[model samples]
Target: MPFENICIFGAGALGGTIAAKLAASGNVDATISVVARGAHLDAIRRSGISLFEAGADKPLLANVTATNDPTELPPQDLIITGLKGHQLAPAAEGLAHLLKPSTRVVMILNGIPWWYFHRDESNHAELQFEELDPGGKLWRLIGPERVIGCVAIQGAEVSDPGQIRLSNKGRFILGEPSGDISADLREIEALLNRAEISVTLSERIRDDIWSKLMGNASFNPISALTRSRMSDLMADGATSDQIGKVMKEVKAVGEALGANVGISVEERLEQASQVGPIKTSMLQDLLAGKPLEITPLVGMIVALGRLTAVPTPVSETILALVSQLDRENCRTA
Candidate 1:
């Protein structure tokens, strides 16, 4: 089940990094096409994607098929989304053009995904979060059966339109929501590993999602509201303590829903502090006048907390402030 026709949709920062790596590797024999827009698409079409890795003497150029129109591409074997949680629904219609009956969509998103409860074994099975997928568009169009959940542990940013700056080389955790180790999952994992991209297969991807969300649900909004970098937030005792409280609340909610976070608040904070002075994506988007990812990152947590009857007073407070802040930013933008 080799994926010959692969597409990277919304090739921004993280998506661009994955696309560049796959195209440059020359190990995975597949046609890597990118669906992007604006100056980034133009530059990629002109000179391919330029990847500036940390401590690299020169940039790595990955030549691939670049286009903004999904309709132009043929049916794909795999479509790895690089868009944020908030960006997926709007592109669902265009994305469908690349899907066939067997196409597997790798959702590399932050926070809770739209298919979170799709095949759940619990009472919340098939529950939809409007905050994450307003109007059930993604659920209806993309189909959860086609979803392969992924948590990207890497940090990257579009330094320029066609240039992606790699902050760190991190691995990806991928799995099926049904907790099955299907052949499709293995094939996709092998494909990614062949491209020199590190990947870990998980049987329980929901736990992995919740583990990652513990930090994202806490750090992203806090960073946006305070306009502080990871190091700065972890440096101040007061701010660090506040972040811990929020993380604990998020943890409590996840635990209520049978998710094991596997790490303590102190350990998570220490890990984040080691990342130096990198700004969270939410903070970056706010500074750049883009729509904040409040719904998936923060709003969903509060919603889930209520669903599980967990007291998330701290998360609720932060959600309120950030939601309004996002509104102001959107209005101005």
Candidate 2:
């Protein structure tokens, strides 16, 4: 059965892009609702979600019901969280209101999630990650069974209130944490495919997770610290070397925790180079004065490294610096 009602919670750039794509696709058999806040919600309610793709002159208006309150919406058949990793914990309970017994939650945010380490039942005793979950609020409220992991490879940003501009297009990698091709995964893939968004399934989602996280953990912080784009980060040899060190430590931690990243550090850096001068989401967030999403991207990996006894000094240092930057930025705000 297809999801009858899909709610997009935290409808910011990435979420808005996905919601706009889906809502514009007439063939998808679902009612798409966007739970957003502030001026974005007001704009969407006044007008629809205005989306502009890279090569297009005009924006497409996606007719999604937009509101600030989750309580105003029906119990969603599927809920996609489009918020940053740091935003999830605070909204966990509010997100719970949109869930029914059978609702599935897909988190398409960047970096490792609170649910990443707890997919295995046998290791239930070892699944607690206080760094990401902070008293296991998300884990307890959302649970692992209803959670599906996603690696959002697309790049997008809000050019204005209720407007999403897609800077680049890429596939969304979807998977079950237990490495199974279940019915739920297929349904979500079909829906996204209908939206004309590329979708792929990963047998070992952890490998895909680590592969994306490798770049995010390394490049995102460096870019934020220096306010540089991918092109600049790749151009300078010294900063590029630092990125490699961070990725190497990340690879060790991933392997220690049974994830095969399947990409070499040099190859990953080369791939980053080809992506051009894209400002990382972290850098963008910092410039926008929003709180940095430090935990899931770098801090949680450091926490995982501690669990598996893997040394992550490079990541540890980067985490400390970026964390301090976040604190000082937030202090004056």
Candidate 3:
């Protein structure tokens, strides 16, 4: 499939950026959509999706069919969701409109997805992750088979309505949950690659996903809780030491769950230290007064530890702090 009809939910940052790039490419017979709400939707419908590269002020404009209601849109071959891991539940009912016979909803979120255990040989296989899935609504409403696994390495977010601040590379790792590379996935790979986004087809996407999680399990909450950027947290010897402790716990959980993450905690900590002064998505969400992704990024990992009979004292410590931040922020507001 060349994506003749495409609908990207949450035209916020990453989704809008990807929509703009797809429009720039002269392929796929092109009926592009950016599903958003409120001022963002109004602006995109009136003008267009404004895309910023490398968080620059000057943004590139691309004409996109932007709407808030999914029902009004045409049935699509693919529905790419750029929503945070927690927001999937609230939007599930609305998302049904985008589902057709062959539509695959690709989730671009950090942390372990709800469907992580589906079809795996591990004892945790088919076990629902309550942290990510909440009331089991997402796993039931959307169905695991319809979810194409995605891990976004690209850093981007909505600077404003109809505008997105994007990083240089997309580097989105894509894979089937069962670890099979299908022709459909190759088609998406071709489309995104043509748009200048570096796409990798993961044979063991779960490993790559959890590897990325090594950083998020440490930095995201630390950023949200401490209000520090990536460099500030990771570069300091003391913070790096704390991160190393967290990584060790995360690796134990991963191993107990049967996903062998082949990297030392020191290496992961050093890698984060070198990423410069980037702000995490959790920090960004906190700044914007939006709901934090505390559940999926941190809570789910700890939940995995419990499921697999692993200990996560460090992860639990951070998760408790971040959850308190979320609760206090919500309460005061």
Candidate 4:
């Protein structure tokens, strides 16, 4: 069955970009809507969503129903959540109105997801990460069965209230946590492809998560602490070596938990070097006076290291430093 009603909840930055792209595509046969708040919502309501891609002279505009309340929209066939890992738990209850029995929730999140252990046969199966999910609110309200794991390799930022700036053209990797190529997954892949968004179906989404985390866990915090770009960090010999150490530790923890990162530390560093001097999301958040994504990116790795009896000395040190930095920024802001 085709998705009839598609909603982009927490449409900010990457989410907003996805919504705008889908709306502008003119190929999707679904009713598109966005749930946003405050000035962004107002702007989207006033003029729809505008996307400014890199090197594009003019922005792409798309009109869609924009609302702050989930109840104002119909029950959706697909709910793509762009909320940060920390923000999901608090908003889970409010999002209930958008879900029916078969609604699929695609979480475009970084680090280890809350439903990482769901449907797994390992000792950690069904275990919840308090750092990400907190008091199991998401588990109780949203349920893992409705989740479709997604790893987004996109770079986007909200240039203004309702305007999105795309840094690069990136693709999304989607999969079922249970490792099944179900009907819903195929439908979503086709829908996104129709909208001209690159999509890849992965059989092992957890491994994809770890593959992305290899760079995120190391570079995000390092960038935050040093206030440097990817190129800057990769250019300096000492900083590059430090990033490699952190990646090694993160890879070790993932391996202990049966995730294959599938790349060497040098290869990962080379990839980062190719991205040039891009400001990591952590660094960008720090500059914007927003709360840093500490837990999912770094803290979760440290926690998992402990759970799997893997030593994360470098990750631990970086976590402590970046966490303190986040607290100090919050205190000042």
- Compared with the true structure, all predictions reach lDDT values of 0.89, 0.86, 0.81, 0.90
> What is the model-wide C-alpha lDDT for candidate 3?
0.81
Ranking by TM-score: 1, 4, 2, 3
lDDT at 117, model 4:
97
Once fitted onto the true fold, the runs of candidate 4 whose alpha carbons sit more than 4 angstroms away are none
TM-scores of the candidates are: 0.97, 0.95, 0.94, 0.97
lDDT of 1 by residue, 285-321 (tens): 9998889888887888788888998888988999899
lDDT of 4 at 39: 90
Model 3: per-residue Cα lDDT at residue 258: 72
Task: For candidate 1, give the lDDT of residue 89.
Answer: 92
Worst 10 residues of 1 by lDDT: 128-137
Candidates ranked by lDDT: 4, 1, 2, 3
| lDDT digits (tens) for residues 1-333 of candidate 2 | 568999999889888988999999987878999889888899998888999987788998888898887888888999999988888888888888888888999888677777775555344433767777778888888887888898988878787898888877677888887779999899888888989989899888878989998999998999999999999999999999999999999999888877789999989988888988788899888887889999889987788889789999999999999999888878876
- State which candidate, 2 or 4, has the greater TM-score: 4
**Root-mean-square deviation of Cα positions for candidate 1 versus the true structure, in angstroms:** 1.1
* lDDT of each residue in 40-62, candidate 3, tens digit only: 88988888987888746777778
